[model samples]
Target: MDRTTHTPTTDQSRPLPHVVVVGGGIAGLAAAARLRGVVGGGARARVTVLEASPRFGGKLMSGEVGGVGVDLGAESVLARRPEAITLAQAVGLADALQPPTTAKASIWTRGALRPMPTGHLMGVPGDLDALAASGVVSPEGLARAAEDATLPRTEVGADVAVGEYVAARLGREIVDRLVEPLLGGVYAGHADAISLAAAVPQLLAIAQRERSVIEGVHAALATAAQNPNPAPVFTGIDGGIGRLPGAVADACRAAGAELRTDTPVASLRRTAESWTVTTEGGEELAADAVVLAVPATVAARLLAELAPGAAAELGGIEYAGMALVTLAYHRAELGPLPGSGFLAPPVDGRAIKASTFSSNKWGWLDKAAPESFVLRTSLGRQAEEAVLDLDDAELVARSRADLREAAGITATPYATAVTRWHAGLPQYPVGHPERVARVESALAALPGLALCGAAYHGVGIPACIADGWRAATAVTAGEVSPDLVSGTK
Candidate 1:
């Protein structure tokens, strides 16, 4: 349906339901798009998005490094989940989706670069032979991992730490050199603190059903192999993953949704029949529903008056700060880039947590700037914030040192850019699943108010999209109503 802007007038005869989605990130954009589909273009509903930042897209941003387009934040979407792909297709970005050029990655550990073991689920090796051949683990570590099959079943309660469980079954080497880096890449968290149920639910489920962790991994792998046509693990946009938000925002506007950037919401209030959203500039909007698509802290503050319980739960969620240093070097200086890039386990005592050889990993980058080798190195993870305190120049220098030590590159970067994400990634501790459930249940009591974002569910692009879709569905369907009133407000 084609959307057209309608002037707001004091005409009660034709009042249409209004939806105000706070935060113009991917989740808010997706929610606005889904709302348009639900309400259609004629006169079903009016949607307005308020973004605090000057630009939209949230973390999915891009910039030029060495005069070449590169993603400054999130770069890829997990293809296994259909939400992101579906949204992209809906927003006329179907043709722009591209898979990574190379999936091969290595782990820098034990003073050497080692091939990541195959047949593993998040570094939990399913094939002992593969793990042994990769030399990622010492002979003693390999033997310990193999013992999982014959060892007694581990008693896992409602939830367990991914690192604790894996280390008990395998060994510290697996947790340090393998699992830690892989999980760190995703959560920017330590495996010992991340919840098995929240971070790797599938593996957790398998472990619960099987006696051995390795056996569970093997079973999971077997199930995956049975699929005839598995989608590529990840997909990116042709220009950059950053292009996604622009497309989504355009789709929303085209569908008649009003999008305003740099408009931070100050407060939210509920009445007997409608909700009131106040912007920082003191403008008030009356809406039939509201979607709190902001970060945990922002969402908590907004929901405090509406749902104190949910607000408290959201406040408990912790976040990790990180910085990415993007550098461009002459291809001749770093002859023949190695496979995609390498990850550094904290055990390696490296300043950077992971590095992505952007030129080698993405075909578009390679084609865009063949003469320049573009790469990005990530610094700081979880509690490692001291490194992020350094100046941009120092951060770049440290990242360069890490790349040189890990990959044997001595070339000076022709250009460099630093992106810092403070409290960017949310940490899912052992009871994260339960906390999320509690937050959801508490919010369910307050109708017309729904929360969605990376903090509540899976952190991937697809998961956030799915969360947006769900929030849109709930608000549009009237499952959540603006009519409900709690004693708090």
Candidate 2:
């Protein structure tokens, strides 16, 4: 049976150019969707999405626990970015769009759950008063932070690690207690290893021109503060972000694109006029253009024979793995919890990195199960994979222990789930920008070829979507130009 859905009517007499997208992840789906949209609803080209896995969505996935559906992967997207939300709306999820609750988060630092400080950029506090009041750092650490304004001009040559630069400016205490947890939440990598330029470009740009990071943060945030009507920080689907990939795939199918799963491309061979994509099962598909929307390693292996330069660069990209442990408890037993959740700083020597009150953060979850409460804890980090190796029972026990200590929740969960993602998040190391540029340079000569994923730009949903559109545009230009994809401009 054909898995494709809602096939739109197309002229059968005309032979449309074929465009093969390698990957069934969100990025690849976005690419196929954009390609179909640009090709006059598949009238100009036949778009086919091929995936190795049986399922789509990549890290965006949903699972059920205790009679309640929960997000087993990413929960939300940056609402300020137009790409994700726009794509969601474009794919008929406009009515399902929902913002998270207004409840603030806390930082588990200095041996307790402290209020998360405002007036900061990625945990680098701009307002010393706010940082002090929040107690994310000690008095001595706060004193050291003040020295950034008086310190000599620090040079961030080309690029640097976020931890290195921030520690040099403020203090290691801030990096360990504050910055690490925040960056871990996003990148799942160590602050000392993650790239400042690639991970936090705005912070890098500020540190480049300004002498004091503090002053630069103020100047950077001033633009947003000046705006009276600021957008919500994030948005989620009524179900979960996992629904996005299916919706996009449905839209692509409706646009007359072929969607396939469990078929991996083994090699990419370039023909004189087109490309030949050989699958693992030895079946072949010809395409005028190809978008390599898979992870770096898989992409490297597939492109080794065709584009060795790109393969070489992509092979070096590292990825971080993590496990999400979701536990469900009776609402009466779990008791009331403050805030959405708290980020656990590694410096505190905690077993779990962070925990989210899924029932509190997403009002949908609360409304879905008024009598049940659900939450999740993240384990493992870049260069710290031992925790991910733990058994599900052990993982759940550690998470429960942490909850008992921090939030004082001693209730046993009625249901539990453990989702492990090995090599899940791509790490952006120092010189990541240069590495990505080199990859682009290598692919420039290879016409009708494109790359898009968390490896190139960002790990967020919006960035991946933007890169997907960029890949589509790169293959065929002026077709899907939009404000969200202006980065490629």
Clashes of 1: 3
Question: What digit string (tens of lDDT, one per residue) describes model 2 on residues 1-489?
Answer: 223333334555645567889998888888887777732233345688999999999999998999999999999999988888878988999999999999889987667899999998999888899999998889999999999989987987778999999999999999999899999999899999988888888888888899999988987888788888998889998888888998988888777889889998888888788988888888888788899999999999987877788899999999999999999999998778998999999988999999999999999989999999999999998889888888999999999999999999999999999999999999999988898899899889888999999888889988898888888878875465445464621
Whole-model Cα lDDT per candidate? 0.85, 0.87
Top-scoring candidate (lDDT): 2
Candidate 2 colliding pairs: none
lDDT of candidate 1 over 1-489, digit per residue (tens): 112256453576866578889998888887887777622223345789999999999989989988999999999998877778878887888899999985589888878778888899999999999998888888999888888989888888889999999999988999999999999999999999999988888888877788988888898899889999988989999989999999989877877788999889999999997888999888888888999999999998988887888889999899998999999999888867679998899987888999999988999888988899899999988788777789999999899887888888889999999999999899999999899999989888778888888997888888888778778878867332221111010
**Candidate 2 segments exceeding 4 Å error:** 1-15, 38-44
On TM-score, the candidate that comes out on top is 2
Q: Give residue 280's error in model 1 in angstroms.
A: 0.7
**Regions more than 4 Å wrong, model 1:** 1-15, 38-44, 478-489
Error of 2 at 6 (Å): 14
